[model samples]
Target chain A: AQRVTQPEKLLSVFKGAPVELKCNYSYSGSPELFWYVQYSRQRLQLLLRHISRESIKGFTADLNKGETSFHLKKPFAQEEDSAMYYCALRASGAGSYQLTFGKGTKLSVIP
Target chain B: DTAVSQTPKYLVTQMGNDKSIKCEQNLGHDTMYWYKQDSKKFLKIMFSYNNKELIINETVPNRFSPKSPDKAHLNLHINSLELGDSAVYFCASSPMVGGGGGDMDTQYFGPGTRLTVL
Candidate 1:
């Protein structure tokens, strides 16, 4: 079965510290990976995707096919960056259009 | 200009009651989806509709049904709601199937409807 695993449930860092949210997936075929962020009292929104290879809000994620991982990273964390982050995967499995999401990681950046 | 919107931002009702949550997307996307976030904050896919046709249905209970009258609207109705149904439901949309540009996989989520069952 295809699944998305976010190992960290909570991560805390200083304002200028580097931040990394680990994500691993289990799938036979190549799947699309995405990172969604949900700020306090706000709707969940797309932060970045593997294919895009673009950074959003100072966050970037690289897809490591060999490792079967798509980890989200940010060189410098800011207080405003604190939020709940979910790792999602889309495959040709039973749920085609729907994405399988991980439990999520709560990121807190202290000033 | 909400691309994807769901009615009843918050719904509090007693168990065994019947309720419906309406969802609509103005982005003209060909696909829509419903996701449930449990109290533990674990999110799961409930259903997906493409071009007003059901394409993906998760292991959700039969008491929950999704109806898509047109490509732009998809509604979820729960018959005899249970306490387990208490969670935040999110409505989302994407471009279409087999259309890959990275953006296709990026689903836009609504504000989410928090359903509380007592």
Candidate 2:
């Protein structure tokens, strides 16, 4: 069974402050981790994936297999970054395209 | 132009009534999905279709049925709706699963429909 855990339901940070959204997972096999963001009144979009190792809109996430964590981090928080963030995991295998998502964390960046 | 779109952005209905939520994707992808987001903002996969074929079906109730008339359209119909069914329903699409190291499993989501079962 593969499960993603995002413990924080809400997180607040002052402008220009650092942001870290914690995420942990439990999976038997190797899994691909991803971070998704949903802005207000907008559709959910992919932020970054561990496989790509690329930063999007100043957000980045690294998959740590040993710790079973793929926490998302940003150097400086911005008001526009405030949105619902979800951590998802996809198991490794052929035809395993299902994405198990966490409960999600609501990040609020105060201006 | 919206890549993925769902109709009836907001719905309010009485209990026991049957309703359908329509979803269509113009991205020409081979896979489509339906997800439910509860009040707690917990998103879960309900159904998935690939090339008009039922590929993935989760532990959802029988009352919730998904239909794919074509590769681009997927509709969800709920019968004898219950109060617990009131939540936001989202439609998404993605390309087929490729070998590796590509945008194969990346899904593009629709605007989502807010269903209110009164």
Candidate 3:
């Protein structure tokens, strides 16, 4: 069974501090991983995907196949960065549109 | 303009009633999906349609049915709604995989519809 796990239900950090939200996945084949963010009163949006390998909003996530992890990280946390983060994994194959998502982690960047 | 939109941002009703949630996407994508977010905020895919054809269907209850009249519209209907159905439903669309050069992995989500079963 394919599953995504976000162990931290809530992660609090002071402004300007480094931030990391852990994400791990269990899949038999190669997976396309993504990070999605939902801010207060805003619709859920895509933050970034491992395939793109591009940083968004100063946050970066590296896919570690050996560790089966794709932890999102930021050098300096900002108040605006506070939101619910979800880690999703898509199996790489034909006709697979389902995104297996982890229970989201709420990040609170306190000023 | 909203890329993806869902009707009735919030729905509150008694259990055992029937209801429907409509979703539409103007992004011209070839694939659309429905996801349910539980109270714990665990998002799970319920169904997916590609070019108006059902492509993926998870282990959702048979009481829940998804209809896609076209590629841009996908609607979900629930019969005899139960308390367990109280949650947020999100509609999303993405470019078709193996269709072209665009990023098919990135999905655009609609404002969720929060359903409360009293």
Calculate each model's fnat, 2 decimals.
0.76, 0.60, 0.67
Which residue pairs collide, candidate 3?
none
Q: Encode model 1's per-residue lDDT on A1-111: one tens digit a residue.
A: 788999999999999999999999999987889999999989999998888889999999999999999999999999999999999988854445668899999999999
The residue ranges of model 2 lying beyond 4 angstroms of the native Cα positions read: B98-101
Tens-digit lDDT string for candidate 2 (B15-43): 99999999999988999999999999899
True contacts kept of 2: 0.60
Better by DockQ, candidate 3 or 1: 1
Off by over 4 Å in 3: B98-102
- What is the per-residue lDDT of model 3 for residues A1-111, given as tens digits with 9 covering 90 to 100? 799999999999999999999999999988889999999878889999888889899999999999999999999999999999999888887655678889999999999
The most accurate candidate by lDDT is: 2
Residue pairs clashing in model 2 are none
lDDT for each of the candidates? Answer: 0.91, 0.93, 0.92
Go through the candidates in order and give the clash count of each: 0, 0, 0
Best TM-score goes to which candidate? 2
Q: For residues B1-118, what per-residue lDDT tens digits would candidate 3 score against the true structure?
A: 8589999899999999999999999999999999999998888899999899988898999999999998899999999999999999999999885332228667899999999999
Q: Name the lDDT of candidate 3.
A: 0.92
Question: How displaced is residue A74 in candidate 2, in Å?
Answer: 0.3
Candidate 1 structure quality by residue, lDDT tens digits, B24-93: 9999899999999998889898999999899888899999999999999999999999999999999999
